[model samples]
Target: MLRDHLQRYDPVFQHAAIGMALISLQGSFIQVNPVLCELLGYSQQQPDSISQLDHAYQDVLSAVTEFGGSLQSQPLPQGTFELQIQQTAGRQLTVTIHLTLIYDEQVPQYYLAQFENRSLLTETKTQLLSTETMLRDIQDSYQQLLEKMPLAVLITRNGVIQYVNPAALQLVHARDQSEAIGISTDEIVDSSYHYSLSERRKTYYEHQTPLQSITYLINCMDGQQKLVEGFTLLINYDGGPAAVGVFKDITEQREKEEFMMQSEKLTMAGQLAAGIAHEIRNPLTSINGFMKLMRSSDRSSEAYFDIMESELKRIELIVNELLVLSKPQSKHKSQAVDILPVIDQVVTLMDVQATLKNIEILCDKPDSPVQIVGEVNQLKQVFINLLKNGMDAMASSGSIHVMITTNEHEVLISVKDEGSGMTAEQIQQLGQPFYTTKETGTGLGYMITQNIIHNHGGSIQIDSVPDRGTTFTVKLPKLVSVEASSN
Candidate 1:
């Protein structure tokens, strides 16, 4: 009655869902339950008649026996694996058989074994493999994204590469992943850029002065050279001294800058020539007058003198033009001129021409002056050029908005147009000598405007969105007390 009650109350021990077996100290199954018979496809043969020493691998089972016997008292070791057995089935199976040894009264002779079907384990393995495949697919997608990016992405801390994206690897031409990581930038950068990087490192690390908006150099992995301009900042990476830097490969930009630099060299010569021409003009004028007087005195000598005098006068006039290339362009000469008045004046000058195309010129101006420095007339010239550019950019009819603001350090004068703006590549090429977007454009307008502003101590920048619009911003320092005194 007690045995029936035990079987009824604790069915798990007597009639478990899984196979059960009893293993002896000699690496053999002494007995197995009905479930074990079912798991191994065995018939209801007596378990006492079956001994399977070969079913459990002799070596591993021996080790398992050793480890199992040495355990403290009650609980079995978890995460244990062993290869073991079924004699009646006549087939060997790789299984994870869990066993608990019970040692109480009779020489510590009993062991309880649970047999989980290898097929079920196999199915579980297959499900895990599918999940692993999905994880691998996700990793592959992330790798592709890193490879295709246009920007060079690097994660570092105080200039150590914690991470570098594939684009950076391709650009720098690192052979493999091992070559790229934890290597100092000095390894790849040229000797010239090495010093610059050191200075930047000092500024950032020792000084603790952040370089969030710094432009620095990077030598690419390829044999081809580049000046990589980047912005760097300190960030946390799994909580460490993480720095992130994103940069563009600026080899082409540097080439274009070289062209601009050449143009600047030529312009500086023009300034010197203009200064020299001013002194030479007075003497040349007197010399030409005396030659004219000599020509009138003798008829035979007149043509010869006339030719000499004419050539001299021509040279003198050319010198005068050079002198007027700029005038009193002193950075000091400035006035409180409202931008609205200036825009109005420019529109008046080009109103008839703008009307020809049926274009509308719009002005969003504040009542007060967006007052900066320099001459009103000079600023009017800048306004006229920009307005005329806007008008010319449109095909049939379009709008040009002159946006004036007291926005920043300098009064901002913006000329925006609905006409097709330049591409990023084209914008980078703007302000270059003889580099214009227009069919008949000389490309000297912005160059001249830039010079005019420089003479008045200011600068200009352009922003554009292709097929949308272009915005030209003129920033000149506001005329102040020092400027008044200098003038």
Candidate 2:
């Protein structure tokens, strides 16, 4: 009966697609199909045993026995394992073996083993592990590069700081990264910029937009303030959205620029000295004439004394304005300044020069005081430069109109001149260093003017027609009054 049963399955076993083998309970092969011989690079004449094919066969047999199933049991145990075996040519191949026990008449016969080749799967897994390791190494290298870069770098997520490079730590006077991480960005940025920064972050988070480069005042951990110019872009970090900022410390650079501006102011004052002298001479002449009249009469009229006093005061006012322009601004603090008064004072100072050029400066003052926050001297310099430029642009008698207008959020001061005017290309080149339209102009005046306005959170717009005229419109952020703030 056993012989008959074996004969019945012989054809199917011999023609099996995968490697197949039948082994006795003693672990020696009872039958080996042609596929099994070819898979292991063996011939029919070679010795065939389960132990010879797999070194761990004993362990597998032990595991099968530990499952508490006897070889002669009715329901036998079956299992699968992965093993590496050596072919006849000494080459190793990984394979999975499915082993099962067969029975005839409730008695165990032999173990049937089916071998499936898994060399390709094992090789593919190894390649995948290698690729992952390479990617990890690349990430580590980038991290090192970021750590060693000189430019300050900061990373934030959801309005909270997540990482700060060493340079950023130094820039903000932070002792370590832990001091800055996990803190709100508002803690470091100046309060004035909080609203704008918040709005920018919102835009970036919703649309993945980038922030343009701009200067910011950062409050350091050590209570010092630093000026940084930076730009930010959105990036994917750790499987989430983040913002990375690259910055440079510009505090020293700004100080240098301030010194250059101060030097230019002095130079400009020197250029206007002739007009100032002419202005002072009239007042001096008036005082001299009044003194002579007082000396000639035994009882000088009170009007003569009053006239002398008025002339002296006028001289004093001109001298004071010159001194203010010539004096070096070592350290100027920004404060709430009434824009109208500053413009009035500038118009007064430049009026002498304007008259010398036969240019009448007609100032259209606002009914109410327009207020802004800025350095008074710098603000003076801005208008002085503008008014001077207007005077220089005109060749003959013309009016330079100074108009002050205000809105809820900003104050606009327009200096319109009926000069030769400028082409669009010339207007575009207004703020460049050493590029001037005037023959004697240094071109630094407009550049410095633009810089001052920008520092004050303001902007300058120029509109001109070639033959008609040119108008320079300056816009500055308005200072909210106490009442307005409370409201």
Candidate 3:
């Protein structure tokens, strides 16, 4: 009897802060703990003398009864619940309930049971929810600030990317958030080193040892690579362990370092070879000029002049290659445009080839206009690149499907090919510059394509399988002006 007393109603019943009660299926209370009496301002009562679960948890009772068996709340699931119960004086009070379904071990039966204070629980939960909402708002504002930032800001746990800022979109050459989120560093990064880095992070986390400092090569999706030096800290999030790393794109730093090294070499080369290059330029121009003069002098000697002229042009091309080390710059603003016209142009360009191969193209667009903010010429380039790649990937009898969709603030275009697709490894490196699978590829085509899309502030995504085909989806944000907003 003494053992039973302690087991049922001793420490937990008298001392625990939460309300405790046993209520029957018929809607009568079987037991009320001291905490329950204090919560509802009722006197402590005997077992089998209590209030009903229906009064306190009407929604839970209804939902459980309607659904049958036990149920849990959504968005955030918890063993505890929020409820309202009445005091003996007939005032209703709100409470937070830690609930359980008591099952008879011998027979098949479930009894509704719960623990919490009625009045205090409601007030506390209400305040906490308000605070949580405020915090979420601040966090949202912070994310927006980060998104507007030019630097690539990312949040990660271990080596997995949790959140990435807008700058990361351009850095990875990604289409958008869909392509960027949940992407592990190893997947988008060029180096195999990130795999080992991930393994090390895992090991440290498993042993609860925080990562101190690390430096290594990291792959970028843009074919622009980097060597990153970073420090990590361990912290708790949502009652669980997490590692947060704040990092900057080290590519520019590496570029500056390489430029300094190259500047020294170039200075020495200029001193040694400056006279030679200058001397050759004068002779080469004179020789070409004399060749052109000779070609016009006699028709029979035209073939010889042609040979000489070809050599001169070849020399010019070589010189141009040397000068191309300094990249060109372009300045263009995003403008409103319809993408259908761009697709039509690509089809026209590739029409002859498609006809020769007996391939068919299918285009689907809405009857209404689909508009977005982007560079029409640049988006045209993106279309041509994607369409040409698709054409190359497919057989003579293949078919290409183009779909255009529009929402209030964006436009989407998807071009799909029914042809040989890419492997997992190839897919991982598809958008990377200089990472082509083709034999005679310069590997810079996709690199240029990705840059064009970034300039337009649009995203491009490639989805493909091993044998099915490839689909390129581009999303461009629509211009949302005050006039549009008012409408």
Candidate 4:
């Protein structure tokens, strides 16, 4: 009856695309489909045992060690595996086997295994391995090139620094790469330029546009400033949106260019001064002679003559200053000057003007002397100009504070005023030749003060907040006393 049933389904079994089989109690094939025969490269005749088809039957036996003792004592096992089989033509074929066991009356009856080709999957895995190796080598080469770049390279996401190369560490004076990571972009940029830079970045990110190169100032951790030209582009970093920047520091070159421009302006000013002095000297001499004659002719108007003479002297003073400013300086004598006394004298001279405006002038100094090597009168001129400007800034009653503080290597004299102060733009233009705030100001007073302070190997720093006040800080290298130097 089973043979009749098999014969009835024979045509269906033979035509099916998938392999199918039935084995007897001894593991010999009782029925096999044509697909199974073709897949295994077998002839029309069936194999004697299923284990004979598996080249590694010992490995298959090891996989079912729990099937111990007599076959009837253990349950049949089932598993999947990849098997390499030698075909009739002696060529090897790799295939996957899904194997199971059938049972009859609680005893092992037959083994059944289905085979499939695995060559395509194996080739795909090999190609993937080669591609991964190539990708890793390319990434390593890019990392090496980034480290060796001379200009600072930075990668940032959401305004937070992510990666910094060696050159970036050097640019910010950082000790190592760890120091700059996670720092905000604002921290490295100069405060004055921070807002503009942030706004520009926002625009670029919003529009998905690349940033153009810009020259700007950056403040380092060491308190030094650098003029940097920077360029930025959007990038995908570590699978997230980010920006990459490259910077070149140009501080020294910019300073040299500024110095050349200043030099040219000075040369032009000198030539104008020489020509003007020649043209004005003759008229000034004639005016002085007439004023003296008028004073003698009219003794009753002696006060008027004194006033005229004073005005003439004031003109002479301005001309003398211009001549000095234009010419290349000859060496001037230097002396050890105790700046406290000079400051005190200038304060005394300016006190009357302060008093007229209902302003109080307060002076503070250390008990110990503050000494510097400079020209005494020149130092006096610098202080006088600074104090006078402080007074002029005050529209009405306010206090002008002057303090002299000494450090190990320098003396700091700060002049602060409680008055309407300057804006940032005004402060930047303070030292230019004809820049001024007062209606009647020539602007030469501040310029000459700056020149004198520079000549004395000192620096001037100004700080102001609009509607609050202004402070002018003067730093000069301290001169060690002879007794101290000897020690």
For residues 328-357, write the lDDT of model 1, one tens digit per residue.
466445666655677788877888888889
lDDT of 4 by residue, 344-381 (tens): 99999999989999999999998877889988888888
TM-score of each: 0.38, 0.50, 0.36, 0.46
lDDT of 3 by residue, 155-183 (tens): 66656777777776776667687777777
Give lDDT per model, in order.
Answer: 0.68, 0.80, 0.65, 0.77
Candidate 3 shows a clash count of 6
Clashing pairs in 3: 19-116, 30-48, 94-118, 175-460, 189-219, 190-219
Q: Could you report the Cα RMSD, in angstroms, for every candidate shown?
A: 12.9, 11.8, 22.8, 17.9
Give per-residue lDDT, candidate 2, residue 121.
92
Candidate number achieving the greatest TM-score relative to the actual structure: 2
What are the runs in model 1 whose C-alpha is more than 4 Å off?
Answer: 1-81, 84-94, 100-111, 115-156, 160-321, 324-338, 344-377, 381-450, 453-487
lDDT of 2 by residue, 1-487 (tens): 6567668768977889988776666655556677887877766565544446545345544443433244345444677777777677887789887877776766667677788988889899999999989988988997899899999999899878999989999999999988999999899999988888888877876777678887788899999998899899788787898889999999999999999999997786665665566667887898888888888989979998888887788777556654554344434688989988899899999999989988899999778878898999899989998998888889999999999988889899999999999999998877644467987554556766777788788999999998788999999999998998999
lDDT of 3: 0.65
Q: After superposition, how far is residue 83 of candidate 2 from its true place, in Å?
A: 2.2
Residue 3, candidate 1: alpha-carbon lDDT: 38
Q: Which pairs of residues clash in candidate 1, taking residues 3 or more apart in a chain or in different chains?
A: 19-36, 156-243, 171-221, 172-220, 172-221, 173-221, 334-374
**TM-score of candidate 1 on Cα atoms, chains taken together:** 0.38
